[model samples]
Target: MTDNIDIDRSLGFTIAARNARGRLVRLGPVLESIISAHAYPPAIEKLLAEALVLTALLGATLKDDSGQMTLQAQTEGGPIDLLVCDYRGGELRGYIKFDAERLAEMPVNPTLFALFGKGYLAITFDQVATGERYQGIVPLEGATLADAAESYFAQSEQIPSLIRIGVTRDEHGCVAGGLMLQHLAEGEEGRDRIHTRLDHPEWEHVAILGSTIKIEELAQRDLPLETIVWRLFNEETEVRLLGGASLTKGCRCDVVHIRDVLSKFPAEERANMADDTGKIGVDCAFCSRIFAIPVAELENAGETTK
Candidate 1:
């Protein structure tokens, strides 16, 4: 983990001249930990990796420290039925549910449409402090997950945006990196409402520069994110680097929590849940860990809660 200190972090930057802001995210061991939890196929592993990167990039934008951002892609008649990933603070977790037979029929490398025929990408933000929640949905009709995100901003938020994600795996493990750029011109109060003008010259100029980023540059572990940002916008007048946050593989599955949840069920139901050993096994899909709770303890669970 010490070697991955430089990786698994998200950095924020702003282009003053272009009136735009962007984020760079790179995942190494953190990504490997998440993918390794399950024996996912190559295609699923790659897709999950990309989703995690997208989650990190978007989740880092939360203003509240306790806020959470969740991204879900749901399909009806495709190989993958559901893809869910969420981020809170700097921690991220995600999983995929798919039909094995459908996935097996896919090619070595399946396209987004092939994996999820007619799906929708939904991004949700939950603010813990304010108890406020917001959601945006867009059709998943692009070649890449980044394209779906771009559509979300274009149709839902009406912000001219560009996103790129890259994932690569080898003998070692999987690593992913992503970039997000948005045009938010500075206004007297704060950011201006430039979404109405999608053809704005400033946004176009920045988008053109952002599109030059290659998959190799984004996924390369040796290439520093700062260098990538510099190479893209160095010619501009000012590129302000903001504070960054470290990310981790976040799967919050606690024995106590699981026990408490089980306690909510009637005593008869709890009894029925336990096996011959008198323990109920609870499995966490995120981390793929199982926790066994003794039924005897749960008998008094409701009393203790009161």
Candidate 2:
């Protein structure tokens, strides 16, 4: 648990012998930043933390570095209505929208169903380089977010996958971590392809090994990610580690950019947005920040641009 041991990063690895791949992510300050942006309750904080970790794990697998990965949970008849998180180029940001009164009525620790009564989880991948986007949606039916993610891979992608996420908060701050493993069976072209072999022996063995990871271990900041991977698959013949990626709190909110977009609106629309002080305020939910732009500025800018 050295102080300099890559606290906020994700490592990719493969067990060559088992035809499996995995990603391990640990968050320290990065999680703290995102959580601190809003004064979320303990339960909501923990849930958002898990979502961010899951986003990082899946985002790291993108073939293009410039691509983006977004995970959103939308529900009806639940305490939590919406939870959104996204990752792009090793940057992560997420927030949750929950009903305070409803959350207060739940038990000390509410179940997934209690928080999100009838929800669907959506995972979207956007490849900026090729302008291609793919998305998968699945009903949120599990005890934890990890279970829902595993369901997404199994149902939508038809891939054998395992995921574990953990979040712990104390007087110091918040820490979160996650691990995801997928069995990629060999194809006829000598490359990995999605195969419908949930009962395959190799996948079963690898999944069993992956399941041994406890939530406590995933949330342990002192334990190095590399050590965790080794402890799980040390018996494997070949475990190749890939390049690791660093993660940070990435809220893409720009005042200039936002203001410019506002300037494009019609003069009457801009006038209706102004407050008593003749300033229009734009709120960004992701970072919980407000941008104040003068109405005169937008009107003048709109006239010139139009």
Candidate 3:
């Protein structure tokens, strides 16, 4: 099964930045491996994997304890309504809500934004084992999801950042790959250096090289990091790899959590749920698992402690 594939060697990136150290980041062997279990449509899977990689890339930026990080995009005029994912400990779980039928007829150009008209993007950070949370919402200003995310960084952090994302499949038709690039925070001096580097003809050469990276080879788990680096940035001076983070597919679902949701119903509503059969159906949206919650069992269970 594809789930058995080791993502440790599978999902990763090799970075090359002038005047900056580069590193290989691996999101464990199981992150994408688990995500691949779901049989998502081609376009949806590509988008999902791109978002999944962002979680890993941004997760590496978290300075606090390992916690839950979520990315969401909502659009009104799009073929799709929203795309969201929650990441923690290198595992991610989420889905996209869209009209699959509508998208099949949609043109590939102008891409996702053409479908979603007006909406907002939001990111939330929740501390693991702690109730603390922080969320920021930004208007969907850019034509791309990555553009929306970059806007969030500028508005919330007041730091100039850029993110580039590419998602595509291989000839073999396996869910292939994605890439992210961001400008590190720096003062005026650092910014000057960055501008000089960007102006260099050689840097443009590297940009072309970076663009040529194939999505198929990126999915190969057995390939060495150096091989990827060389393929993308061969003969480029001062190439280096800084570091990387690993990821997997995970969901925050549990029996207790489901019960808690049921408890949100008033006592009267809970009573209304009672049928002669004494069973109420509770389904998980992500996994589509149905739990036949028993009224009698719930009554005996008492109030759930938050």
For all predicted structures, in order, the TM-scores are 0.94, 0.95, 0.70
Give a tens-digit lDDT track for model 2, residues 92-182.
9999988999999998888999999999999999999999999999999999999999999988877889999989975658998999999
Write model 3 residue lDDT over 137-233, tens digit each, in one string: 9987876676777688667754444444444444324333344443332343535433544444343444455557665555654455567677766
Q: List the residue pairs that clash in candidate 2.
A: none
Task: Report the number of clashing residue pairs per model.
Answer: 0, 0, 27
Backbone clash tally for model 2?
0
Q: Write the per-residue lDDT of candidate 1 for residues 204-302, one digit (tens) a residue.
A: 889999999998888888778899999999899999999779999889999888988999899899989999999999999999988999998987777
> Cα RMSD to native, each candidate?
2.0, 2.1, 5.2
Position 72, candidate 2: lDDT: 97
